[model samples]
Target: MSNSTSETVSFFILGAYLNIGYLRYLYFMITAMLYIVIVVANTSLIVVICVNRSLHEPMYLFLCSLFVNELYGSTGLFPFLLVQILSDIHTVSAPLCFLQIFCLYTYGGVEFSNLAVMSYDRYLAICCPLQYNTRMTSHKALIFIILVWLYCFVKFLIPLSLNIRLTLCGNTINGLYCSNYLVVKLACSDTQVNNIYGVFATALSILVTVLPILFSYMRILRVCFSGSKQTRQKAVSTCTPHLVSLLNFSFGCSFEILQSRFDMSGVPCVLRIILSLYFLIIQPLMNPVMYGLQMSKLRNICKHVLCYKLLAGGRNTVTESCEI
Candidate 1:
């Protein structure tokens, strides 16, 4: 196709239930339920954190931020995906596709940045317990959250804006979601600038986010080794949830980056689709579940909320019966 034709054409999302055959309806039901579960789980955690006065420390605030990010990321992808699953055509307009890429990519960057902030919070609390309160004040924690989001926004927006000007070689996006890397692949022009920007952004993102977590954990590990049994147990209780979250997010992100940057034509189409959606689908669901089960404070708050909700539900039933 001609460059002009390709440039104006909208993208066909070639990965939508590509190998699912007649199970598209079943797939839609399963994903829709999964989406609801994600929504409820993340929302519940966010609400619990917000409502509890005792949970107002930096660590809980960071957990709240992480939950919010999960919800933000999932919302950007799942609604459009559900619609696409039911629709006969799996196409996205060029503008809409680019918009999804921008939103979802921003989500990815912010996720890491938030994790890094959480790691820093843990480091202060564990390794430097005496100064943790004064250093990790509420105001400072809020500033870090704001900066993490702002940095992610400007970082992802630059390349996405640059991408909008590229003349495309094709209109087919080979994956389920709109990936910045995959979109760049379709460009017909010399994408050297875009490629460079992507590399710089990726490297910087890892440095600013993942490296800190690794470093903070290293220090925490050292302290745990030297400290008494009580200290080690305290460290394990507090740090394990964050570590679990980081590992889960890292795994999902690795698969996503790998699939986006590399040629995965040899991979099975079904498996490729699963890998592509892993981060988008799994992280939101997993983070809250992990934290809920692992963190004592959050778990208690959740139990209390569940009990309150159940009591209210039962009261409504009894009141209805009395009126009848």
Candidate 2:
């Protein structure tokens, strides 16, 4: 592969987009609606947590971080996707593609790190109820959130840098969006450094994020079993949403990884596309709904806020009607 050949490639052709004919508009509308829902749901929750003084705890702070990340991740993908879906050509400029890759990878890393920290917060609250305030202060939780974002942003840069420098023999990607793995596969140059570093980064990420989650949950479970019924009920009530969210995200990510790395030609194209996008789509949409409804404090506050707004609007309408 000539260096000139790689240098000549200025854009990438996404090969997975199907010829849905007129139904493209339908798909675009559905995708647009989904994006809107995700944005509204996550943003509403973030605002709920931020404005309510009573909700300013370690867990709520973590939830706020999670909601913000959902917005970040969805914004990275949805706008780009809407444009592509409407266009006749399914091509993306090199710079834009790389930017998307950076946004998405960092989003994933931060999400995992946030969830891990949230698990640890839960552990402190449940396992060491007396010392939770001393152990996990709001200031400390803020620091952890800042560190999680910074660490993920910095950690993913290595791969993104390596990826951008690659001499690609091809400019075709077999997916709906820019993927680091697919981009690396197109490289004509030796990718031993990239491959080795990828493995190392992935392992390190799992060790850091997964270990804390496992340890925290194990302690929580131990306490639940040995303690009174009230202890068990408390653990179930608080931990259920977090556990559900973690499992849902894990499954979605697993589907994405499997779709990306393995040959899935036997699978239907529509199903394959859905499975590939499951992590990005489902997690953003699900997190807010799960957390908002499951947590009693959040649910009550949301209801109160919503009812107040509705009543205020009704009062204004009645006043205007009387004046007319």
Candidate 3:
């Protein structure tokens, strides 16, 4: 890369061609298993939502959208990495690399946009209860969903385009996937504009996603504070998932920025692995855990449906015995 031998190194997911050691292979297998479990569980949750007609409410709809985004995002990283690690082929072409970045951004970005949309929905639902039905109509929900994807589509391209023709120079990324920081580090050209634009991108993340969630909670807090103890507890229960997820997301990303600013770029690989693990596993894990466990309605409905399925199976068995 120093122009001595004109050799260029490419950064691809390191899962492929791992170090020649048993421990490294063990790490790869561990991640692979975790990735597979996440994909299956999240995919099943999404399927359950789609198949169950009772979960047609706006709130669940938002959660389903989020789960869908997670499905896409998870597919981009883990499955691909698992394959690379197992097969020992880490090389990815430029187009495939860009595609990976695009897919990840689209998947994750849409989820962020959808969170804001969900927050606004909550605002309207709680703030103007009487008008909730009319305001969040099927037509309106459809329009809003359309807008979320559009906004995400545009927002994703902002960072991606900022790196236009900006080569990664001599470094293949260290991480398992294509990322803004991973890709940008290799550019030999003046990257100030991209960095400044990155600040704007970070601001967009905070302004559009983080701030709205805060605003939603702030409003929820005011409402809950004025209500009875039961009402306060209910509001807290309803908002806890959002709060947890927001903290996970905000803290992870903000740490990245703070660390980078301090010239502390050599963050341990394990930390990065933890951050990645949170999204790949923890976020998906939270969906069913919070919604099914915390919400009385979801729990009740699940119980009823499960009971029905078991009863039906029993009845069918009885009929078969009688026929025999």
Candidate 4:
């Protein structure tokens, strides 16, 4: 393919999709259900947090932001996957592909940034209980949330811009989605600039997000060790969910990075597909369920809401029966 060919390339062929025949419909149904669950679960938690004045603390606000990101990321991927799964031709238009890349990439960036901020919030609430109120107010928490999102979206635009200018030698992507790394690999032109910038951006993102998490946890750990039993219990209650979420997301991302960057030909196609999607699929589903169950206040509120709705429906049914 000539340099001019890249400009003319309008769409990309996703080569990794296996011919599962009629089973594709089964996959579609399953994916559709999972998307529904993710949306409802995350949205419910967000609504609960927003509506309940008692839960309007900085930590809950951060949780709300995290849930919103889950919704954003799941929406980006699940719809595209549903369409591609049922279609015989697994191709995505160049423009749509790039857009998906932007959404997914920014989603991941915001997720890490949100988690880091949440860790810092936990640190403040635990280590500096008295100053926590003055230090991390709801207004400041909102500002942090806004900044995390804005920073990720703006920061990722650099790479997206770089990606769009590449002279592609190929149009086939090996995975279910358009990956920046995979797309860059198809470029016939020198990707030295892209590669260099990629390394820089990735390193910067990791450092910016990871360093705060480490520092926050270190201080939290210190407090837990020297403080009273009540202090340790408080730290454990709050930090456990965050720690689980962080580790789960990090594990999925690690596998995705490995699959994208290295040769995964030895892995089974079925297993590879599952692993590639693990982060996107699992994190959104897991976060709300884990948080809803683990956080006593949120859990109690959710139960109250559900019970009220159920009772109201039952009363409406009884009233209709009497009228009839």
Give lDDT tens digits, candidate 3, residues 123-182.
Answer: 776666789888887567767777777888887787788775675455455555666566
For residue 140, model 3's alpha carbon misses the true position, in angstroms, by 2.2
lDDT of 2 by residue, 1-324 (tens): 233366656899999998889998999999999999999999999999999999998899999999999999999999999999999999999999999999999999998999999999999999999999999999999999999999999999998999988889888899999999999988889999999998899899989899999999999999999999999999999999999889988898899899999999999999999998898999999999999999999999999999999999999999999999
| lDDT per residue (tens digit) for residues 1-324 in model 4 | 333465657899999998999999899999999999999999999999989899998889999999999999999999999999999999999999999999999999999999999999999999999999999999999999999999999999998999898878789899999898899888888888888988898799879899999999999999999999999999999999999999999999999999999999999988899889999999999999999999999999999999999999999999999999
What value of lDDT does candidate 1 attain over all alpha carbons?
0.84
Relative to the true structure, candidate 3 reaches a TM of 0.82
Per-candidate RMSD, Å: 2.0, 1.6, 3.5, 1.5
CA lDDT, candidate 3, residue 315: 100
lDDT of 3 at 299: 67
lDDT per residue, candidate 1, 70-143, as tens digits? 88888899898888887777788788898898889888888889989988898999899999889999889988
Error of 1 at 223 (Å): 0.1
- Clashes by residue pair, model 2: none
Global lDDT of each model? Answer: 0.84, 0.93, 0.68, 0.94
Per-prediction TM-score to the true structure, in the order listed: 0.93, 0.98, 0.82, 0.97
**Runs off by more than 4 Å, candidate 4:** 1-7
> Which stretches of model 2 miss by more than 4 angstroms?
1-5
